[model samples]
Target: MTDFESTDRPYAAFPVRIGLQVQPQHAQYADIRRTVAAAEEIGVDVAFNWDHFYPLSGEPEGLHFECWTMLAAWAEATERIEFGALVTCNSYRNPDLLADMARTVDHISDGRLIFGIGSGWFEKDYDEYGYEFGTAGGRLDALGEALPRIERRWARLNPRPTRDIPVLIGGGGEKKTLKLVAQHANIWHGFGDAETIAHKHAVLDEHCRTIGRDPGEIERSAGVGNKSPEDIGKSMLDVGTRLFTVSSSGPDYDLGLLRDWVAWRDEVNGE
Candidate 1:
């Protein structure tokens, strides 16, 4: 759906949508499913899985998983947590087909899906998948074209998204990427500590203003480790970051940090 109506009032509190980007690179599907179910049951706001082939941090050729199929399963299994790929590569699928798949999963999840995506990166995925590993600019150009087609296809899909499917784009590229987020993303996810994230947030705002769109129309999010959630959370929150994420992975994916962040979310919400 339309991201939001442009507004002039002071922006509201960023919703505490905790994201757990469960890496599938080193984990079995059943094990990963268990981890996802547990997190949903534990009151996580968002449950995410990375769209990757090899383990990002562990064994390079470990037991890995594809993104869309796993997300389809996640949609059916979890009833609570909003689920999606942490960011799907724009090059991997035709944008219209991707939109249709997202719509189908939206129905399957009864509208708990977030259409998270990004311009393709990771040369390995491109090489292995046979997608052109072109320049970064070319990939972002693909994304720019794909997003509108995705939106258009969404309108023509037989069954509309059960709920407005939120488009979540993750990146920190200042030029085309941030501008795309301003134009299309309902949520822009960034990976950085407080200072880096704050800088990106301002850049995103400038992009929005340049396009005549209000920056706060999109939710600004960042992913950080749980080691300093308190300080990071307070710091990012001070600078307009509402969505904070801690990524987890493995055969026995732990939800300990996730629970702690949930408590932190309550404390902040209480304040």
Candidate 2:
């Protein structure tokens, strides 16, 4: 077993933060906007949306909005809360172009953008959008290639990003994905129970060590799905996860869970 206690994980000093993934499916944009507003008002730390052409759950043909465009609106509409796609599919757009888009939104939000990205998965999204659905390894390789281009483009852009826009890489593929996270991500978001996430954190820490990067520099983030603060929150917190995100889908976009998590965060952070 790896000694997780050896290195000082960066998140150990970070206060607990709660994020709300206002999934853009099965709801009108107005409702989505309202949800964001409510989240900000409730003092949630970050608001996020997934980058997909269609809904991930519910009706296949349900109402869905594009990711970056809606993010632009969020940038202008809200203040104080950071926002971005939960994880933008790297295959959907060119690396340089995506960098420019992220920079523009960064400016719009006065630097509240988190550049979350991942290797493309959803086959339907690729097929419907006319992107080639290649093998998983091929896609991961592409993501590995794209990240550098994205960074280089950010460096080349005029009126560069307001701040070093935080890069949040989502996925738990230990070999490729975690390696990428160790190489680039400022925040690493993954899905799993507390025990599983703790194991991933250990794997990620080892990757960081191999590359000579501080394991603490990358924040560990997880999705809180149906689990209350009392259920998995403390367990995740004890395991070094500083960022916890709860998702709410369109139409209703109920923020009750988000509010509960926010309260939990405040309690944990002693705010």
Candidate 3:
């Protein structure tokens, strides 16, 4: 078995992707676009934005925009950078329709879309949007049902995704969520330090084994919060994780951490 908790694996090996989640609350479209441009110019691998109606941090009534629409605009604005929501609320749209929208965005980005999705959580997004924010279990149930519908829709949608758009599921719920990740997600993003991540990863491995899926086929990812990549840099790379994302909340959209993380990725990857 490959050890994913040490930073000595050729140090300069494996595919490394550095991502930034641009918090779209309290920012103008111009600033958001500039942030995207800066991230691309600075060599960030993937630039993302969250899908929310109300700001998660700061003033709840602050500025926030819809996700897929911003993504489509990002697709048209930037070149050479992958784009998607950090995670889209699954309850907001029909799975088939979501898949089709992703397909369209894929073409717009010349195949740079990552279909990052999750079961809808924030109650405001559900309530105000007229979506029923069901129980967490029910929501996971919805997500599980949505994934296959999306894939099927992609296969059936005329013109298809410009590329085989990857599905990224973010959640750490071991029982149902990780199981779904094992079965369907191309990338899995979770919130955990090394030990928790290792435990969850092991559980996911077991899930993969049970379902006859290859664990190696899924790329592990995590959000970089509070800690600078400079501090936890090697630890992240050690854990079989190739995708690193740092989230920036708006009003500032500060990217100092993200820039540092990107540098760390480049160094670790020998770029």
Candidate 4:
């Protein structure tokens, strides 16, 4: 048996959740706002945007909005669905400052913020934004150092977070990233097909064992990239992935896929 199968998976207790990534590119703020509202109305469990200065897809120089600021606006625009960047780059802001910003947003959203973060990538963002384009290992090390500072900052904030903000770290690196996920994340977001994701889960579970943390304590999240729920959702669910995200890019933030995923989630959860 694989390491994950050898142990009991307490993740069955977590209900299936659907997330929509409202890609902040090629669209106006109004379109993005409307999309977030629609996703909330459709009963998505979370809304997310990526942390990037430019578009990751489609016309590279296309219109784009900053991540955290848009998230703060999402806090005010939507009422129920939790929201945050899919993964904020650790190199962009000071850990303490980021913590304070997250705390403020959490309070604004009435504790609905999910603080998803990761090591820096997308070198164009670094070069254009005037941040250092460090080695990948250096960025990972920085992320490792920043996580604790962020937690400590939360403790010291004036009117601390409304609740302990859930930290969602996104990446699939088996060594440093998975270990960091075991050490700090409440949710681990990865990108892959079922076999790939199942392998990552096993690695993550092993990391949890080394740290003496329960593997089930960390939620598993994956992207539903153009695949129908009937095609890939059951396999992902069988591997203990409870959060499935669909990404909608703007000018037209088509949510047809999101609707399918939401229906699938409800069906699987017996809602």
- Higher-ranked by TM-score: 1 or 2: 2
Each candidate structure's count of clashing pairs: 0, 1, 2, 0
In model 1, the worst 10-residue window by lDDT is 1-10
- Per-residue error (Å), model 2, residue 33: 0.3
Q: Point out where model 2 deviates above 4 Å.
A: 1-10
What TM-score fits each model?
A: 0.93, 0.96, 0.94, 0.97
- A best-first ranking of the candidates according to their lDDT comes to 4, 2, 3, 1
Candidate 1 clash pair list: none
Residues 232-267, model 2: lDDT tens digits = 877788788889999999788888888899998877
lDDT of 1 by residue, 1-271 (tens): 1122112322334566677888886778988998888887877888888777767776777889899999998888888778888899889999999999999999998889999999978898888878898999999999999999999999988877777789999989998889999999889998877679768888888888888987767887788776556567666666667777777878778888888887887776763
Q: Taking the tens digit of each residue's C-alpha lDDT, what string does model 3 give over 204-238?
A: 88899898987878888888787887576667667
- With candidate 3 superimposed using the best TM-score fit, by how many Å does residue 156's alpha carbon deviate from the native? 0.6
Residue 217's lDDT within candidate 3 is: 81
Pairs with backbone N, CA or C atoms under 3 Å apart (clashes), candidate 4: none
lDDT of the candidates, in the order given: 0.82, 0.91, 0.84, 0.91
Model 4 misplaced regions, further than 4 Å: 1-7
Of 1 and 2, the candidate ahead on lDDT is 2
Give the better candidate number (3 or 4) by TM-score: 4
